[model samples]
Target: MASHPNSSTVQIVCHVPDTLLDGLQVDMVLHSHAFVIRKTGSFRNHTVRRVMTRAPIIITTIRGGLANQMFQYAVARRLAYLSGGHVVLRLADDFEAQHERVFGLRHFNITGHVMYESKLAVTLQQLFPAHPQPIPEKIIVEREYQEFVPYSGKPALAGLKTLLFVPELLAWRDSIQLAGYWQTERYFADVPNLIRHDFTLKDPLDARNQAMLARIRSRPSAFIHVRRGDYTSPYFARMFGSFPPAYYHHAAQILRTRFGADLPFYVFSDDPAWVKQNQIGGPDAVFIDWNDDAPQCDLTLMAACRYAVMSNSSFSWWGAWLGERPGGMVIAPRIWFKSIPEFQDVVPDRWLKI
Candidate 1:
């Protein structure tokens, strides 16, 4: 089976002799089929059977840090699963050089594959030469040739041919190219087990993180994630501001009262100094200063904890979601974004929001 250069559908090419051509029958497998037959010679007949074995291709542009990438991947995975399509993760290269945002999905045990923008552009050029506008050099930039599906908190139509998810819509089409940080649990709630399996870590924790993981599992630990850095910047603060100090304090108090005052807090943060200065965890907490180079390690440690006090960041959100315990508590800020009004879907219904 070979994948189409322009579409996500895989072509199942089959060759049949001229003698058997009349009697040959192809069964409808997963979804649909596009059959092509050609005569190679006077006595020989070549039958090329192209079956849409996989769902329509959902090529989504993945950006930001690990958690954000996971969000994009999960949405695409669910969409593909529902529509019987394949997913091609288009990693945004512009952020790689500027923000050091590497395509970190490989670090997880995800089933989907990824393609570089340059390779996708070359494939498009070879496939669609008659197209007027060139594919944008940056995947984030809008182009007329691409079909972008806008999200407005509604389920997408069933019969869409080629849908592109830019932000708002939840659509199911034969083929779609999605681009959004779909932070809602509702998108993948039906396939929770599949997502949990896919999001598992590809590699085991290293010695340093493993030791920390042991400590996290040893007690009634509460994982507290403090996200600063980018959120504190003047421009980003307006849109994605840091959770106020009071939020953390309230979350800690709730966790302590629910669990126990002696419950040890495992603190994870991009800015360890800021966590130290703020004294977010207090005397009973352990500050995990290591694993700056390995962010997934931090996530693993966070999940290992029995309870969680998450930040507004998606990074911490995944930590809490993955590490969720049956009886344990997860406290999050009611407000996810400072500017956005419709982030109610970001947090799960079960998780408490202070």
Candidate 2:
């Protein structure tokens, strides 16, 4: 019932140092960093203009929904912090055109410079003149290296992580762009408070949510998240399947056994009607359907809980993670994706995989 460091572990084959242990508390080679970060400050130039920084800026793009955007920002943010670099984001104009998503990073207290796409190329060339092929060598996708062939090559599933905390990345001196999901906690494990604070909502919760927050804090509470909507599409359905009713039944029982039998469960889902019909969170589960259009509010409510029954969705994963307490329990599905059997890096080592 208690969360401890991970015992059994896997390695990131691409120059990921041996001491960088994921779940174990041994000689941690994974704790490697190689950068001389200059302190950032503003100075006045001879032109009477403000010079923000001389430090290299790691420019990454944000082009996904709320949870996805968070991951993109987090990895880049951690890189900047470790290397004494700054983050410059290129918000894609086509995300809204392709998917029903707007630039979602503004909702949190994220620190970064947003560059217009029109000006990005000129700035990149000015910043790093040594790089060739425009930015090809600088662009880091999750599978840019040869080690990813086992999982990404598609001949047969040899099972590799969706992404890895490549130790080589820490030694980079020039600016780079991250184009992968980078959905692993190892990126920011040592800076929990900093990451949690950055994810805090910029705006206050609404009246309805405020009352709900009070209720959640008043007693022993747990949250349940069900991912539907876009997840029902064939692409998403094939990548990550939904959890069955039995999984929830057993997860809820696990919480009840640990925290009291009548532990009140607050449910957050894309489909509240389906949840109510199936009683996924149990009959007395409080369905939070009001914040569908407002993810920040919904996540606030989810994180307010002391425990969580996580859906195999990044949205739910963050909710459980953000609100985690000392002895809190988070129950996640054993399988994250149907195709990527080796990509289990997304789940935290402390969480229970049932």
Candidate 3:
């Protein structure tokens, strides 16, 4: 079972990179008493009323893509809940110590602290601190280029997290390589965060989600994810792939025949345009537009759905895993992305492979 912080006094440090701190600011503030500090001295004289040493506090960081950032957030949230201290993203000069060594870049003061996790409460309990030991530098900084992907917006995801444990990360890396295909390592190098905890997708549009759930609760509903991309850059273009339009169409057909047209299908995807061009003509299908506002929340909300139809992307993997409901059905491509098992593990055992 998960736990939560029970402290009142808190000290949060924004330790996000120079680039990603801004995007996640709102997410951090919502969870705890969070603040951005440029140096260690920033917290010099702050008064902490609570002092519970048994509770754990989190100072987390990571370097990976957006999917990786989501993983990091998931891990940090679980760690904080399990340990009792709120999660804090340290955003000070000293906080930049490890990042500068790993990335070999000198930029500091990244983006947002709220998006990934909340800062732990500032209390005397933290003075003794109870958290996982730090992962070594070798594991954290080895083979930097092996993890790069071609997505232009990768920095958005990479910048969204901080490094906490390096050994666990190295183990995850070694496992992916052992699975075969060196290229697979890059894509999955940062996936440990997903395994840390199960995410529960919430409704994106607060009012609409409440309204939709209220109505859908009275009847049957299905969530569909129509994926249409195999991200293969020029270097790895040989792996270029796209799912057959028939894949989604066939799944939709199965659901319609079994569940009836009266069931509502909430279509969640990264690309709405592609879905429109290829979606099965079903009156029950309702395409949910993310509106490009909160990408992280939109994805999480989709994952919250009990029923899902996933594509072959880590983005969808996290969502499907989180959204899985008891006795729910998840339909995914049997042969996903160049016939690679590395990319296919996103399909959990609960999902039906087509």
Candidate 4:
């Protein structure tokens, strides 16, 4: 994202780091400090262009780990794609470094952004004109995952039922802020190929992962995720309950019925000790416990397997999505969360909810 202004003329040449799925290359021409893009081949470089007084600033908080970052990013990317805007993934808290959880979005080739802000509302205030109206907490509240209410015509202080897309939130225009953990593919459903490309790792797997990859793809395989780490706590357990061994037992059974009795099960987990103690993936299943320092490798191996038995965790949810092949099976828990007893849109319709 470099801009070179011709010293001899009033033209500005800009190289887009990368645009959305459209493969659109944009070149910006500076006009009075206001900016926009020019499309060349249904996308463009330096022709007459589209002008924007203020492309809306779609701000979202970046918290949790990789999967959570992915959710936050994908939703923000979709919003910016739909209505013109610049994406801002703000660091919501400082606890991530202490937890050894990095902001994983930078590892992927993603789009729809100007900056990843860390300060609270200062960036928004600096970017936008002085407030036309006061914003309550400076975020627009989307009522829930179920309802779609158009923006109420303010710099909305939005809050809501999260983990799934709600369309009414799209009505928000101009500078707006968001704070939610958006899961599920519905937001980017129409462009699965685009999302896939965007989420693909920018680099190849390491030596350990490459060896694991070969091993995973060699057999009639299924991957089981036992997500325990934080789920053992009282708060997380009550809000989002951990899966019991029974869930994996039933899922493995289903996979065995389809793939044959010898189908090898590869287990991935944050707490492999707990997994072994509970015999979550069965006594014969192979435990993949070395990638705690590099969870992406674990995710890669999970995606390579022919079958996936996911826990309620988003980490495995992503692995299953990336690994889904023709004639493959993905088994999700019938109950994803203890708080929301009814099923959410997190699981795809084609996946078996057992």
- For each candidate, give its TM-score against the true structure: 0.73, 0.76, 0.53, 0.73
1-354: candidate 1 lDDT, tens digit per residue? 776453454556666565765433222122233333332212122444333443355677777788888888898788777766556677544547754766677667775444555556553333233333223212322232234323212343222222222443345544555565667777677788888888878779888788878877877788899999988999889877887667887889888887788888888988888888888888667899888778888888888888899898888898998888688888888888777656477888799988
**80-109: candidate 2 lDDT, tens digit per residue:** 776666677765434466657766666688
The per-model lDDT (C-alpha) reads 0.67, 0.69, 0.43, 0.66
Per-model C-alpha RMSD: 11.6, 13.5, 10.9, 8.7
Error of 1 at 31 (Å): 28
What TM-score would you give candidate 1 relative to the actual structure?
A: 0.73
Which stretches of candidate 1 lie above 4 Å from their native place?
A: 1-54, 93-95, 121-173
lDDT of 1: 0.67
Off by over 4 Å in 2: 1-52, 122-137, 144-165, 170-174
Q: For model 1, give the 10-residue run with minimal summed lDDT.
A: 136-145
96, model 3: CA deviation in Å?
A: 16
Please report how far candidate 4 places residue 305 from its true position, in Å: 1.8
Please report, as a residue range, the 10-residue window in candidate 4 with the lowest summed lDDT: 1-10
Minimum summed lDDT over a 10-residue window in model 3 is located at 173-182
Better of 1 and 2 by TM-score: 2
At residue 155, give the lDDT of candidate 1. 44
Instruction: Indicate whether candidate 2 or candidate 3 has the larger lDDT.
Output: 2
Greater TM-score among 1 and 3 belongs to: 1
lDDT of 3 by residue, 1-354 (tens): 112345433333334454443322222122243433333221221222222233444444444334544544444444454434454443323333523322111112121122111232332123323423221112122232224322213332222122212334332311010101111222333443433233333223477655755554555566676554334344333452556667777887777677675656777665677777766436546777753444455455565565666666655665566555666677776765563344444445556888
Where does candidate 3 stray beyond 4 Å?
Answer: 1-66, 75-204, 208-210, 213-218, 229-240, 281-284, 337-344
Q: Candidate 4 — what's its lDDT?
A: 0.66
